[model samples]
Target: MLLRLPTSVSEARECLAEGAVPIGGATLLWAEWQRDGFPALAMSLRGVPQANALGPGTLGAAVVLHRIDDRVPDVLRLAAAGVGTGAVRRTATVGGNLVGSTLRCLLPAALALEARAAVLGPDGVQETDLAEVTAKRPLLLDLRWRDPVASAYIKLPADPGGRPPVTVAVALHADTPGHRRLRVAVRDGYEVVEGAAPCDDNIENALRTLRGTALGDLPETAWDAVDAQVGAVLRAAGDG
Candidate 1:
């Protein structure tokens, strides 16, 4: 199998039409290729429509991360930073993250924020809820957001090994007073354990896990212990 590394959107479209698999950052996909030897044409979308444009807070195709960084909530930017490391962040597309099913942290934050997905398929451009696309369809392109809102992504470590978290959660909150809403999602790797839009139940459940007996062994309570550590970091960042 061959790999087509395109530097622009037109080339990406051409490769897709040629039945090639779109690859962003080539981090997660390459890892899988090395481990499993899954042979498929690999296509790279680096520097095509621009790097930061596919972030979770934009409504249009032009709504990249660089453009919406000032407006999106702080937690989301933190999740983006956590997407692999510095090198991956520079090359990975938000579109690729959602498609790769890498983890729930970043996508859930976008979902909590009421983000949408913008896809340019064989049929042309189409739009739908970003979370829905991730949950259901084989997404093609970028992720987007509808209304003005606040979003947060959380990851909780398991045990004292200091490993990457086992459970990841995200929340999106509406800005309006009477119309306020929250969405929370909990996942391990690419598998979703729980998700609630207008997240009263999940948040209550999360807080409960910390306060009460562990429920269903989902790490809801363990996260509370981790929250303190995460909070200190946030506080330090704020102080800085």
Candidate 2:
């Protein structure tokens, strides 16, 4: 097998034109190709090119989360830096984590950070808001975020109860010096709800419906835990 290591997306594209499946970090994709040591033609992103800031007010795609966590004073950075332990955090690209969906814990925070997904697909390089990107069907390249915002993610580990555990992500911003802003994602079931973060009224309505109609659908223990965790995380984020 020939392995082509590229430093930039363009270089990777050129290698792809030569028939190579791109592997970023290969943290997750490597398992699928482990027996054969990757496909016959594979390009490994051994080292990324010099990462430059993109968009208005200094945002960047290539900046690793470690740098971001140290620089940004928000809960989302804390959540990003804490995802999947140290080894996974070191190897998993923010881009990969974003595309991996709500399971890995970045999607909720991305929604909170006000991050954006930058794509270089068949249609060419384009950027979309992170919240929008998470809900769409597309190939994702990288995630971008603005400076200085607060965000947080909360989830319950899988249990033997046969129910998908609870997961929530909350983010807040200061539009003016003191005007507060918020966004939240609640993945209660197969559907993910995106709207104003900390929608207490909506939560009340949902809870009413959940109690009135969806009670038997979910185990009482699981539902109670999910509700509590979501409330705790939201409270913490609001204080943050």
Candidate 3:
């Protein structure tokens, strides 16, 4: 396998244009390699200064999950911490989670946070909504979002070292004093519901539609937990 280390965004773009697969932490790529063999060309984003940067309102695409903690928003931190084992978390990245095939904890968190992404493509770099970038699966540079007034995340029951079947993330942004806008994002749905807080019926309906399965498949206890968690987050955000 040939690896290209780019020190700047321009170099990274050039490598990408040459058909080098962009790699961040490369945890997911490693899995793909195990099944499908290694690609001929790959570009490591780690060497790029911009891709490693993290700040109050921005998260570099190459930033590892373990690096996301108290410094970031609550919902994001919670989601990142739940991703995988300590070692995996240390190697998995924000960009990989956003575009990987499997469901990742950070996806919902980012959606609820209303994050925007900077992407580098054949044309050039452009700033666009995170949702758009995810859908298009472009080469990501970083993510940016305004700090929320409050945020929360929750996941349903799962084995000690296993991922949950469902997860939810909520963020409250203050539009004006005493008026907070609520945003909720679900794991499988990849859709964000904004404006008013969702009721139990709304939650149930969303789950049913998003999972593409009958609600009866989930136990009553699971529904209760989801309801409770959503309410708790809303209350914590002072929206309930």
Candidate 4:
């Protein structure tokens, strides 16, 4: 089948309606086509709407990963960088990362930041919590999130020679005088964790407790390492 390029979201959805599969970055789709054979009509998002509008952090689905790594907040940059090396990142896109196989980092990081996605489909645009997009993708159009006071992303290395499977991202909001709220997401399939402690200086305990529950299934030694690492991240967030 021929590769089709749509200059706008509406045109892309029309391609989908005509049985074309959308391909952002073409990284994931290309890998699949190489592993299996491509008998499907593919739609490339190269010219889609808002391709690189990072000024407001409005990441278009087609915006390449290298740009995301260089432009977004560190938390998300770390997540994007963790996906692949420099060249691969340049070929991957925001929408592709959101739906990448065995993705254990970016989704959680976006969740921690309270990001939202606008999906465009034959049914039109639907606004959704970015975290929810992981559950069900609808041809991601763009992603947006509020700037947090501070945010951090860390991936615990997988067991020797294995790919990292457990990653965590945390963001803090100091919207109130004495109460500081922390939002976090781990790649453990658990719901986004939210907790509040009294003031920015007091969030260490809250973070420790939340991580403890989420990492409870690990062996004691592993849990200890995770706890210590998370504690450091929380401290850095507070100080930032």
For residues 1-240, write the lDDT of model 1, one tens digit per residue: 687866655666687788887665565677878888866686655545642353335522222233335445555666666655566666565666676644644665564455666665566557776656666645355555554344445665455434446544344344555443444444554455433333223434444443342223555454553354333433333411
Q: How does each model score on lDDT? A: 0.52, 0.55, 0.74, 0.68
**Candidate 4 per-residue lDDT over residues 1-240, each given as its tens digit:** 788988877888788898888777776677678888885688877887564466455677787777765467667878887876888888888888786544634777787677888887678878888656777777888888877666777766666555455666767666767566666666643333333233356545765665555444544544454455446555676552
lDDT rank order: 3, 4, 2, 1
Record all residue pairs in model 1 with backbone atoms less than 3 Å apart, i.e. clashing: 52-65, 53-64, 116-144, 182-199, 209-221
Tens-digit per-residue lDDT, 83-170, candidate 2? 6667777766555555543454556566556666666555455878765565663445556666434455666676654555556665
lDDT of 2: 0.55
Query: Which of the two candidates, 2 or 3, achieves a greater TM-score against the reference?
Result: 3
At residue 187, give the lDDT of candidate 1: 53
Candidate 3 least-lDDT 10 residues: 192-201
User: In model 2, which runs have C-alpha deviations exceeding 4 angstroms?
Assistant: 35-37, 50-68, 100-102, 131-141, 160-165, 176-179, 188-191, 197-240
What stretches of model 1 exceed 4 Å from their correct place? 1-11, 34-41, 50-56, 59-71, 102-104, 135-139, 147-149, 159-172, 175-177, 188-190, 193-218, 222-240
Cα-based TM-score, every candidate: 0.64, 0.65, 0.81, 0.81
